[model samples]
Target chain A: MKTLVWVEHDNSAMADATLAAVTAAGKLGEVHLLVAGSGCRAVAEQAAQIAGVGKVHLADNAAYANALAENVAPLVVDLMSHHDAFVAPATSHGKNITPRVAALLDVMQISDILSVEGEKTFTRPTYAGNAIATVESTDAKLVITVRGTAFDKAETTGGSATIEDVSGAGDAGLSSFVGAEIAKNERPELTSAKIIVSGGRALKDSETFQQVIMPLADKLGAGVGASRAAVDAGYVPNDYQVGQTGKIVAPEVYIAIGISGAIQHLAGMKDSKTIIAINKDEDAPIFQVADIGLVGDLFKIVPELTEKL
Target chain B: MKALVPVKRVIDYNVKPRVKADGTGVDLANVKMSMNPFDEIAVEEAIRLKESGAVTEIIAISVGPAKAQETLRTALAMGADSAILVETDDEVEPLAVAKILKAAAAEVQPGLIILGKQAIDDDSNQTGQMLAALMNLPQGTFASKVVVEGDSVTVTREVDGGLETVKLSLPAIVTTDLRLNEPRYASLPNIMKAKKKPLDVKTPADYGVDITPRIKTLKVAEPPVRQAGIKVADVDELVAKLKNMGVA
Candidate 1:
């Protein structure tokens, strides 16, 4: 059986997680890397260097520039007929398109897989990683979305594979990218950062948020985060929210500032190696899970801590 | 134009779920079951789209055991015009649920389908896109805003680093994100009226879609518990401990 792994890239550069997806696909069968996007020659060339890959297929087109599922779905469906399984990184786009491909093939999909036990069985988290469930899919064709953090990226051998410019299979139709409003921050991304500084509703407002969270993140060279309560209160953007419904982060060091931890919030960050909680309320839920707890007013304590650092 | 919403019944978000003492699975014997919080957002968005005059009707659906009708009823009380129950006694995997929904959509033929980004129980945010793929339609996921105009729907989604907006033609699927909108509580009068709203229940077999799960679950285990730590008096002491632990 041959596994078709989708390589996700920025059109100019490949996503680091795609390497992890390629490594996970190696466990099932012989792997073929599929690079789909305009100006993806370098990505296909990079995929060919992964140690276990058998071949590389490039479907570069102008229609793929925006990468709406409308265009990518048909291409995957077209390619899937020749393979026994399909795999993609469990990133936002991968989560969006992989299942669609599975539905197109009339087979079941196993998503957010953390481990592959055998050729047909896998383990994944349930209830926001609170519990683990092992599942086996018996269909002849399998589709899975691999958790990038769970697998190591395969080493690159620096080889170039055969590149093909497959024609666009479907119309781009009406979709177009209008504009984007990205949060500009000097800190690293929350997912990959070694340290994270998160605030909660106790921050009061966005203007006041910079006082404690910013300097502390600067001290630790960490990413900034917010509880859903803080985000809902307009203290930060939705992307900054860390909770069951928001992003899952497993940083090395995590600091909670003025956040009364909710279970949903803890579910996302409890995996951090070291946790520090700063709050006035001694009974705050965050202290229960934190490795270090400081009971005091953050307004008074944070400035001193930032200065001391 | 019409809208279709799919809801799932999951462990109530407020409850701290516990594994069975026997290590069989989560203890559901007396646990509270409610509509997945994200699905509530989806239902709320569909109703808002209808109230904005873009959609003519709204249909809510759930595919699970008979008890899932309560989840659909919650949708009706919140403002869905009708409901359909795809009754099944077996555990429905994400793919099977998507297939059954595809069958349901083939019957309803709505202009748009809305679902929560993921069901909290399984956290598999795949069904919406799967249904879209099965129906050969466009999809906009993790959408905070969905605007329907003419034959196209513009959806604003929460992507990494920031927000990205995509426009899809009619008959598309949109999965709701957390900031989409705060769902309203069902009023007593609305609840009373919802009791009279039509809810059609049918088995998955009726639609020729198999509800059997292809995946078998071997075990369910809780994450290792985190040990409680000490409370520090001041920043100096905390940093001292951190330095000693090689974390500073």
Candidate 2:
């Protein structure tokens, strides 16, 4: 079987998620990386060096600058005839593009796949991570979005693969990029961070959330996350959400302050190396998975902890 | 301009589904069912658009078993002008649902089509984009905020890093995000009024669509259970443990 993995990049380098997807793609068969963007030759070169890749397909065009699914879906479709499996990291870009490719192929998309039982069979979580379902595809071609945390990142450099430039993947003049408001990250990105400090609904308001959460994150030099409840309560931006519907992170040390640990929230961060949970309720479900569970008021404990750190 | 909103019936968000003894699937029998939370947001957004006069009508549609009519009724009570049911018991994949919805959109000539980012049951997260692809229309997915003007719509989408605003021409599709809006509860009067609202039932056959499953469920199982870890008495103990791990 042959596989094509979408290499998500910022024109300069690839996202770690893409490397993780490569690890997954390598599990199936011969892996080919597709680099789609303007001025992506640099990204293409880096992708070509990935250990498992057999070849790199560069769909270089100005239309792909934003990695807009509208434009890149057609590019993936154009190459669909050549590969038996198509894979991408389950990032915002992957979630946006892979479904369109699957739909255009008239196949059911196997999304957020956790494990590859076979070339056509895979495991994924449903019911907001409460249960796992193993599904098999009979479709002639497979399109999958892989959960990056479930797989290790493939080696960045090894055997050199040949790069080919393929064009004429027509512009999809449907939607245009207006703008984006990205987090001004002074610390590392939450998903890739070594340490993460997260708050939950009990943080109350945005002011309190920042006042209580940010100082600890600064002291620990950690990325901050919020449970979906906190994001919904307007205590944090939607990007800060860490739950079934939000960014999944697997950090070395995860500290949860005032979090009740809904199953959905656990789906995102339970894979961390070590977890410390602090909440007033001794029975908070977060303690079930925490290495250290402290039953205390976060208002009292967090400030004291921050001063000590 | 008419707004087309596709709703779905699913296990309620609050319910913890139980995997069957044989691990075939989650047992749906006697489970509490409700309109998918994301679809509720979609319906609420369409109603808001109608109230703002940006949309002249709001049409709610669902493709499922007869019980799905109850879901549509809820949408009607929430302020949809009418409803359509593509009644089917066959498990229709998201591709087929998108095709069925595309046919409905063709008949309605809706200027805007709204749907949930993903149904809670299948979690495919495909219908809106698939419908957009099939119709050859623009799509703004995971939309937290939507604004409309003549022949143009702008959607603020919730992405991984932050918010991204995209501009799409009218006759497009927008998928609702959790932050779109807090859905309104149906009032007593509206619930009564909804029963009288126009509801048309059809089938996938009427739309010339085939409800086929391309994927097969090989097995169903529970996610790996994490063992309950030890609880420390205080911060000093916690820090001491972290220090031993050398990751602090």
Candidate 3:
């Protein structure tokens, strides 16, 4: 089976999630990486070094600079004639593009598979991770999005692969880029962070949430996360949200301050290696999954814990 | 110009789904069903656009069981002008649903199509993008804010890193995210009036589309349970435990 993995990059550097996706694609058979962007030769070069990749298909074009699904899906569909399966990371970018590819190819796209059970079968979480479903595809070709946290990252070095220049499906002229407001943070990215400090609605306003959550996150060199309630209440940016609908993080250590652990919130971070919950409510559902439960007022405990750390 | 919004009937967001004993799938018997939350936002956005005079009419659509009419009525109560239900009993996958919606869009001829980013049941965030691809139209997905100007629309999308703004020509697709708008409850008068609104029921065959299962379910099971751990007495103890774990 020949598999094509879309390399996730920011035009200059490849994302860690792509390495994890490469690991998932390695299970199918020979892995080929597709790097499509303007001036993204460095990304293709980076993709060529992954341990098991056999070939890197580079589509360097000005049209793909924004990575619009309109242009990228046609390129992927054209490539699907040679490949048996296409795999991508379950990031926002991947989610936006893979379905379009599947629809164009007239195949069903499986979103966010956690495990590759066989050549045709895979397991994925549904109903906010409360249930897992194993599904097998009958389609001639398969399109999948891999949950990066569920797979190990492929070795960044060792094996060599060939990079081939492929022409892009230039400018579909469907959507135009306007502007972006990405948060500039010095801390780690949430999905790849080793430690995460998450706030909940109990943090009150945005001011208090930052005052309490940021210092602790900084002290631990951790990523900042927030419950959906906190994000909906305007305590943080939408990117800081960690829940079923938000970013999923399986950090080495996850600290939940003043979080009551709604099922949706737990769905995102319950896989953390060690979970610590500090809440005034003794019976908060978060305590059930927390490895270390601290029943106290976070206003006092979080600051004190930050100082002690 | 008219706006087309597609809603879905799914297990309510707050309900905890249970895997059946035989592991076929999640048990939906006696479960409270509602319009997918994101679709509620889509309907709300459409209604708001109508109120703002950007949209002349709002047409809500759903592809599900006959009971989906109830979901459509909810959209009507929320102020949609009319609704269509492509009734089906079989589980419709995203690609097929997109095809059905493509046919519906052809018949409705709306200037804008809005849908939920994903239904909470299957959690497959694909329908809107797939429909866009099938129709060869531009897509602004996971939209937090949408502004419709004459022949184009500017949408603010909730992407992984942060917000991205994109402009799409008329007859584009936009999927709702959480921050789009807070859906309002249908007042009693609206509920009473919604029953009188026009609801057209049809099937996939009417659109010359085939709705078949392309994926076979091997099993349905519960996720691994996380065991509760020890409780620390104080902040010092918590800090000590973290040090021992080499995390801090």
Candidate 4:
């Protein structure tokens, strides 16, 4: 199987999620990294160094400045004829673009695949990760979004693959980027972090969330996260949400501070190696999955825990 | 301008799905079914558009079994003027649903189409994008904010890093994210009025779409259970435990 792994990247560098996609694609067959962006030659050069990748396809275009699905879907469509498999990290960008490409190919896409059993068979979670379904696609082209956390990233500094320049950079005139308001933080990104400290609705307010959670996260050098309730309550930005709807992370350690575990939130972090919970309610569902559960006020427990560390 | 919204009836977001004893599929025998949470957000956004006088009419469309009519009625109660039920007992794949919705869009020629980013049942986040592809329309997926102007709509989408704003031409597709808007509950009067609103039921064949599954469900089963551990007396004990396990 010839697999084209969509290498998600900024103009200057490749994203860590792409390395996981590369590993998943490597399981299929020859892997090629597709770096589509404006002046992404540096990113392409980095992608070519991944161990399993055999080649790098560059679709340098201004239209793909933000990886807008409208502009990138056609580029993916143009390259579809050359591969039997199309795999991408199940990130926001991949989720946005891969479906359009699958639709253009007239195939049902296998999304958030947890494991690849065969060329067409895959295991995926549905119903907010409550049930696992094994599905086999009959489509000629297997278009899939691999769960990034489930696979180890392919070796970063290894082989050297040739970068090929591909054309078809026409804008659909359908959509345009209107800028972004991203959070400015020094902590490791939640999805890529080795450890995570998450707040819930119990954080009371945004000030408390920062006062109680950020210090602990900083002390541990971990990413900060929040449950959907906290985000909905405006205690944190939507991007900080760690749930089935937000980011799924399987870090080395996941500390649930004040978050009562909903199945939605559990879907994201239940796969972590070690889980700790600090909540006032002893009956919180978070305790059911915690390796170390502390029944106390997070405001007091978190600060004390931070000071101890 | 007319806005079209698609709703899916799935196991209530609150109810955990129970894999059937034989594992053919989820056991919906007596479980509670509700409109997908994301679709509720979509309906709310469309209703807001109507309330703002940006759209003259609203249509709720659902592709599922006869029970899905109830889902459409809920949408109508939420403020949609009318409803369309694309009847099918088949396990319709996203591609097929996209085709059916494509046909509806062609006949209605709506200025905007809104749908949930994904369905909870299958967790397939492909229908809206697929429909956009089939209809050759622009798509703003996982949208948190939508501002419709004369010929274009600016939508703020929920990306991984942050919110990303995209301005798409009118007659585009917009998929709802969780933060789009809080969905309003149907009042008694609106529920009664929804019964009076027009609802047309038609099979997938009416749209010349074969609601066939392109993917085979080999098996469905329970996920691995997490082992619950002992509760620590306090934070000190918790940290001690983490250190002992070399996880701190």
In the range A55-172, model 2's lDDT, one tens digit per residue, is 9999888888887778888889888888988999998889888888888888788999888998789998888877789999989999999998889889898859999999855578
Off by over 4 Å in 3: none
lDDT of 1 by residue, B1-248 (tens): 88999999889998887866665567877889999999999999988888899988999999888999899999999999999998887788877888788888888999999999899888888888888877778889999888898999999998877898888888888999988899999999999999999999998788887767777787888877887688999988877776776654
Query: Residue-wise lDDT of candidate 4 within A151-228, one digit each (tens)?
Result: 898999987999999987668888899988877889899889999999999999999898999988988889999999
TM-score of the second chain, cand. 3: 0.99
Local distance difference test, per candidate?
Answer: 0.85, 0.90, 0.94, 0.91
Candidate 2 regions exceeding 4 Å error are: none
Q: Quote the true-contact fraction of every model.
A: 0.72, 0.76, 0.92, 0.86
> Which prediction has the highest DockQ against the true structure?
3
lDDT of 4 by residue, B153-244 (tens): 99999998888899999899999999999999999999999999999999999999977788999999889999998888987787787678
Please tell me what DockQ candidate 2 reaches: 0.75
User: What interface RMSD does every candidate have?
Assistant: 1.7, 1.4, 0.7, 1.0
Q: What is the TM-score of chain B alone in each candidate?
A: 0.97, 0.98, 0.99, 0.98
lDDT of 3 by residue, B34-128 (tens): 99999999999999999999999999999999999999999999999999999999999999999999999998999999999999999999999
DockQ of candidate 3?
0.90
Q: How do the candidates rank by lDDT, highest first?
A: 3, 4, 2, 1
Between candidates 1 and 3, the TM-score winner: 3
